[model samples]
Target: MALEWLVINAGLSLPEGFLAYLPSLDYLHDVQASASSLSAYISPAVKASLFILGVVASLINASVIPSSLGGPGNAVLEVQAHRGGLGHRTENSLWAFAHAMEMGVSILEMDTVFTKDGVPVVWHDHDISPEKCRGDFVGAYIANLTLAEVKSLSCDGQLAEHPQAKIYQDARIPTLEEVLDLIECYDNKMVTINLETKLDPLAPNETLPVEKYIDDIVPLLERRGFASRTTIQSFDWRTLIGIKKKFPKTVIVALVELETLMSINGEYPWLGGLNLADFNDNWIAAAASIGAEIVSPGHGFPWTDTIHTPGYEPFVNEDMVKRAHEYNMRIIPWTADDEATIAKLIDDGVDGIMSNYPQRVMWVGREKNRYVPRVGTKHRPHCLVNA
Candidate 1:
């Protein structure tokens, strides 16, 4: 029966009468003398060989079978390298992105702020911090500097205090165009770019106007053929709304910091003037209403006290995950680096994880047998050399 099942389901043909040498069932007996006679008909060596073959066949079948055939419930969770593995390399630098691609992360997560001349550049903060960059314009905002001026700053000194700071050498800030060009030219494997549009509401006038910001980026994405491969993420739902209206084919991710949702006055700047109370404080539904394909909430630890309200404890619980999945929306918690917290989030049934150390997420996924390899790349173990 096992051989027949394999032939039918596994598309393998077997020799006719392969079991013809075996004794008929009617002649079989449980008695020791009958058993001894049975061994004579089928030699011990042949019996052992058949057993090994059956094991091999079963393994092959398991690999090819679909999830419906008693396989895992969900596909492998996506591993997004936040700011191109900021834990290991200088954040948002081309060098960091290259190392992340080499490690075969499913997504290269980055943030973008426009330069003074309206050119989109890959940078995390609106203002250049002395901690991350060194130049005459160390404390100046990217919006006030041209792309050339921004590129002159060195990112290598940003990680001077890091244990692996020596690895950071001569790295400069890269423009969004340059990053896309590198991905197109060098990376052979499939990877998603989760690019966040950085907008500051507190000082809105200092950043690019919303209309111009979208205008500048959409064309670049279309020209580079990245609209399909990239997901535009933002804390500001207005930007997500704009993208949905203009580039309907592009994917959007709604980033939510739970503390930002604790507003009782309905004035959460991050929500783009949309009140959480209007959505019953359900961020998942709110994100879905704006055509967001994914909802990314921060991991509720370390920053919880800083972001969370005194009494509110909004979190990415199992119920929230179920709600998002029901809407065909994916839930990916952002910026989790520790194993224990990551394990908890996985237990809550997140669809993916965004982390500064994506290799850690990949490792946890492998431990659970849920790690999915990149489409065009062979399975490579998580890069742990730096860790």
Candidate 2:
């Protein structure tokens, strides 16, 4: 009977040496099966071996299997709501930014273009586009328009086409001060504010006096007690340098847009004739020389080889990231909302990502166990999402 039990336990086969132990295991089972048949031949050593095997199996099942099922721990990914969560509402409107706060991203990224009245308003493009602004205001220029006039134009043009943004229709173009109010009202410090300086790129005459504009905006942020949490960024190195010199303690980031630079009146031939290749060596160096700590370029510059130039390979590469890091500057890529593209950027070790959909980036960070959650979402004014 002991031999039979051992053979069954061993799946009817055993090594030659283990075959000798089979008789012993079978005897122990037989003795245990019936108290009346218990025998002194059953050794405590065999009982201990069986107990140890059970313990080992339990440990393996708990540690190995659960770990395999759970996969990797959560990773932290810097999630900057591009134009304040373009996913939920119209991009850059006060309502949209408020919505982003509700989504609980690590950063609130918004563009600042001076109104004709010299007011620095939060907006992305230098001029309003047909895609975002519908009706008579579709192609109107932003720089030439006053804050009141710009406010009158609705950015929720896509609302009819995309119902998710229905609440965005009445959204107004919020002033820099208004954004600060939202931040302060929530008492949210985990969230950082990234303000993009959208200066005149096409209409050279529309440019604002650099120092004066900087003074106006910086003071407002300081007055609101956001100087420490606020980060000023611009594609124009001069603006960044000016802002840095005036507010030396404030965090400053340099923004780079590849397509805009390549455009006729954009940053490249229009602003400085420098492309992605010359950015790190020349453009980025200039900002770094002025003590700029963060550099945000288009994500395509670091990952893709497909140049917008037909039949031409992309000039941007991983070398750009290495060079930026060596300078002790953080690299935060811009405007990538797709999960796959964002994952690639995070994997490439970017300091942060500027995405329209901050939620996706936030989840990516939470999944990787490395995220720092920001302030209240536009959905909930009092809660924060932490990773």
Candidate 3:
């Protein structure tokens, strides 16, 4: 009934840079859902005028201005590069994070699992994947390898099955501090790290115990001065609970997927003794109970994505979005790459998109009038990535 102005602004630090007062939910949804409506309905002259208006607006706003775009109240859409743009380069390598930072990803989404000596290193699988890495160190569990042994391997850059992936044949598994130090050098305060604990609840022996993360991981982040800029996420809620009880101020993200939820087994201790059944099976409330500010569900979780298999329904639809906000929690689903799926997530009003290809998501956000984190030119160290 009323027009609302969503002033999507960035003051250079907080990820919450974009802000817009939407007129109505229905209106925003209508606009987000209509990706091609402008080309279909608007005249060429008007489109050109809108393009020019957008250029001028971008000077005033970080994202392309909404005045010429589909709808009003286009707030910030946080774009996270899964495994720090895994689709672009090697997954979780210093090379990957640096490339993603250059590409303007709001969050460098990487997995962190403990090494044999209790040092936290950035790696996705507890057991190293043969497809992604190669060396004498291949086929060994990351937990069995000391930090030095893990670092000796070179990345093959074959992750996520992206065929055209730019391979950095010499890339190595970066320690958690090395990854953060790379970001520290880039000096982009707007960017953040979504560091996942990468622990599997069902297989506890493969990864280190939760206390290592609480004792070592938290302090590392704190010392780097990135404590305020980083988010600690995990599928196993055990570590999340530990961090909350000890630190009490860390930004905790409770991750949910079919496996972690124990979809077949009912209540299991995946959620740090807080069962989903106890919260009426509402994962949002379960996450909120632990002082989690964000609840990240697997994309199209509990079901599956139609992108891979058609006719499958997504779990993060409109109603779920409302339910998440009701608990004062944000829903940032994971690692989707397809354009149609990405647009649908944006339409669903998810706070962010964790994608292997963040540039594609940013393009969609621009088309849909959401905050696309400004891409920065590289001033990073030359010896690091050898561009």
Candidate 4:
């Protein structure tokens, strides 16, 4: 009966006596037979081997097969450009965003802060630092300056720590509207945006009120028709919950640091007054309760060094990935730049990775046969308009 089913559905016939050596499928009728129905009968180890072989074959032939058939493997892990490829360009600059798009990033990760006049702008830091920018008004707080005032600062200088790095000139702070316009005009229309709302718990007045922030940004996203293509992320869970209540369909990413989990004193402000201990440090469950479909945890880099205690463990591990997957959540770690670490994360089964150098991540993805091609445009120059 199994052989007959295979011949009818898959167009393949086994030897006449194959069924004699095969295990009986008393429950076969309960299963839906498909092209890859044989996978159910195979051992898990053999299934995995077949999947790897299929991926290699597809890569060699330049064709993709449905993952259900064990063909091109699982869904492609998303490669997000952190602050628009900050490793190679000034963080959050338009040029950096364009460069990342040219490199074929799956998603552009950035931060949003409100200008003094209540304009949403693309910037990472709450307070301007002279290390990344140079202007007449250095060390100014972003909330205190108008959009025009913010634009006067040039983020073209190389970081003093990395003096040998390339420097770009005339790159000024950009409004959220400007960035959305650029993404729309970009030839590759499939690239998504992961915009983080920069809110300070210690200094709430320095940023827009939670209600005001939602009111200001959601409309902009809807007007730009990016409500579907953007994921609103934040360390502050309150804002995310607020956004979820308002825009139910819009995706939200819960960003976490080691402090969020390891706060023995329960003093972490990013949790929005929720105690990690209450959830037994299961941040994934905590995020899901608030309607987050994705969780972006900090990569356990030694330099960050937040989780080095005797019992402390990296937040994004194999168990976390498995648990997240069980709940239909994605685990995409942040700012992984080193090739070795990126390779390890891919091995650990992350849904995606946010990196400062997207090119490096792309290379690793290709090596692992996990590279997801861009949705539009095959070839382009480094700049958007020229491309």
Alpha-carbon local distance difference test for all models: 0.69, 0.61, 0.71, 0.70
**127-206: candidate 3 lDDT, tens digit per residue:** 87778777887888888899889878877746556876788886888888888778766655556788999777677788
RMSD of 2: 17.8
Best-to-worst lDDT order: 3, 4, 1, 2
Worst 10 residues of 3 by lDDT: 1-10
* Top-TM-score structure, candidate number: 3
Off by over 4 Å in 1: 1-73, 158-162, 303-314, 374-387
**Best-to-worst TM-score order:** 3, 4, 1, 2
Query: Stretches of candidate 3 above 4 Å error?
Result: 1-74, 263-266, 301-308, 379-387
lDDT of 1 at 158: 47
Candidate 1 overall lDDT versus native: 0.69
Q: State the lDDT of candidate 2 residue by residue for 86-191, as single tens digits.
A: 7677777766666775665667888887877888888777777776775455566666787778777766667343356535454567788877777655544445
- What TM-score, computed on C-alpha atoms, does each candidate reach? 0.74, 0.67, 0.79, 0.75
Write the number of the candidate with greater TM-score, choosing between 1 and 4. 4
Question: How many residue pairs clash per model?
Answer: 0, 18, 2, 0
RMSD of each: 12.6, 17.8, 9.3, 12.2
Off by over 4 Å in 2: 1-76, 134-138, 159-167, 259-284, 301-318, 372-387
The predicted structure with the larger TM-score, 3 or 4, is 3
Candidate 4 residue lDDT tens string, 169-280:
8678888887887775554345678999999666787776877677778878998887777889998877888888887887889998765555645466777667767777
